[model samples]
Target: MYGVSTYALHSLPLPAALEQIAELTDYVEVMDDGCHYIESAEPLLSYDLRYSIHAPSRSVNIASTLEPIREASVRVIEDCFSIAAEVDADVVVHPGYFAWAADRERAKRQFARSLAHLSAAAEERSVRYAVENMAWEFFFLQTPDELPLPDGAGFALDVGHAHIMGCLPAFLQVPIDHIHIHDNDGTADTHSAIGSGTIDFAAVMATVGQNGITPVIEVEGIDAVRSSISAIRPYL
Candidate 1:
């Protein structure tokens, strides 16, 4: 089955977005930021659908060189884990970025430490998390060559991000625990409808089938989400 992300209706209130998305798919990945920031599991209990959370990434940087910021980032995600546990939802997390090219090594060390802490936190909560490969050069884990993930962390592949990084083909060969599907011109992260961009959804769907995973349709608007669902249905 395919899933949809609240990113498509991020302008709406969380409850309202979830209500509308429920009409489209039984699986939903809540983009836990902006209007949908999940403070608790209370808002999610009303839904009969399956869930996965795209953890709050804005202002969160597990790779910060500053000790306090790194600690705070881990805590933010730990808070997200607590809610995910209640909903039995796996979370998607961005691998943090470095501020400067010179700080890359230090940032890598910090990210490793954060992952170790998050692993323990997630284990305690009985929830899983997948560290997503990023779209930009400053972010860590932009390619499969960066594996194996530390602390037994799972991989959440964003096909659009991979395409922008020009590594989608390599990513498809790796084992993916979760996936976010969207199309974009090779240059920008537009999150367009499936058929409107350059990504070959046929190959993407073939990999999804082989991996036995549900691909979350993470487009920009409700209309695009609907189009993407229709575009992808043939492969399902």
Candidate 2:
């Protein structure tokens, strides 16, 4: 099935945001962030929507070299997983990034450890944990060969991020369990509509469908969400 993220209406209140997209789609990937919280789930539970969650990644890095900070990041993500279990939602998470001075190999090792912790937690709660590829220069899991993908964990393919890294085809070569579909200008994560940028949606959609991966259109704004749906309908 296809869906849209609550991120598409990021500025609105969570319940109102769900209201806006409810008619347009049956699946809704809630973005568990400061702008939208798990507290909104009570109101949403009454709806007929199936859910997934994008765990908060804007401020916390689970792979930080600092022990205390890394632990805190894990705590935050565990909280997100708890929320996901409550909503019966699968989670999409960014494989944490590292600073320029941090030991890249060490950071990668630490990230693997973090994923192990999160994966266990997800398994206990019966929630699917997915690690998303990142677009930034220092992000981890940029290539399929580098992805450990840990036991019980899954891959969340972000087409926009893959485009930014020039690794869309490389990513498609891997097993994708979930997807975040959006367009970008090849230089940034602009979250543009499907046809608004350089990525090839037809091929992307074909691959996603072939793989049986449900895609979350990660666009921002209601208009963009509607436009993207229309642009992608044929692929579905």
Q: Which candidate has the top score in TM-score? A: 1
Give lDDT per model, in order.
0.94, 0.85
RMSD of each: 0.7, 1.4
| TM of each candidate vs. truth | 0.98, 0.95
Which tens-of-lDDT digit does each residue in 167-236 have in candidate 2?
8988887788899999988898899988999998888998898899788999978899989988998887
For candidate 2, list the clashing residue pairs, or say none.
Answer: none
**Mind giving the per-residue lDDT tens digits that candidate 1 earns over 55-132?**
999989999999999999999999999999999999999889999999999999999999999999999999999999
The lowest-lDDT stretch of 10 consecutive residues in candidate 2 is: 35-44
Clashing pairs in 1: none
lDDT (C-alpha) at residue 131 in model 2: 89
Counting clashing residue pairs in each candidate, in order, gives 0, 0
lDDT score, residue 28, model 2? 95
